[model samples]
Target: MPATPNSFSVLSHPSLDQSGGGTLSSPVTRPVPLVESTDLLRGSKTVGIMHNGSLYRLQATKLGKLILTK
Candidate 1:
């Protein structure tokens, strides 16, 4: 049997400066599936994120969109 791949990787290219200059920085790379927002949403209409001791709500709309509110 073929061995299953254990992990995934993603390659990101550096952005170039618009002032006729070369690349602004070196490329950045990371593992695949960096963030799965859906997983965090977890079939819920809202999720809470706390920042500076304040709670923020992220809501999923009927139009299949997201809205963040403090």
Candidate 2:
């Protein structure tokens, strides 16, 4: 099973730094795209998701939790 963001947003968790004044209603600013569930896979902890003008690797744990691994 894959983890579904409880907040319907790929960038809503508190772990994300939301100092850009983006809200649940308006979650994107300056082209920050959302990460999808299909991007996550078992045994594959690294994912390429762009944010803050850089490519980030998002990791998924055995518990189906998505996290920024890099």
Q: How would you encode candidate 1's per-residue C-alpha lDDT over 1-70 as one tens digit per residue? A: 5533544443443333333445645443534344455876998889999989999998889998888999
Query: Which pairs clash inside model 1?
Result: none
Tens digit of per-residue lDDT, candidate 2, span 1-70: 5655543324444435466534355444443456456555545666687778888787777897877744
Clashing pairs in 2: none
Question: What lDDT is reached at residue 6 by model 1?
Answer: 49
Report lDDT per candidate: 0.66, 0.58
Error of 2 at 53 (Å): 3.2
TM-score of each: 0.49, 0.37
Candidate 1 local accuracy as lDDT? Answer: 0.66
Q: Which ten residues in a row have the lowest lDDT in candidate 2?
A: 6-15
- Name the top lDDT candidate: 1
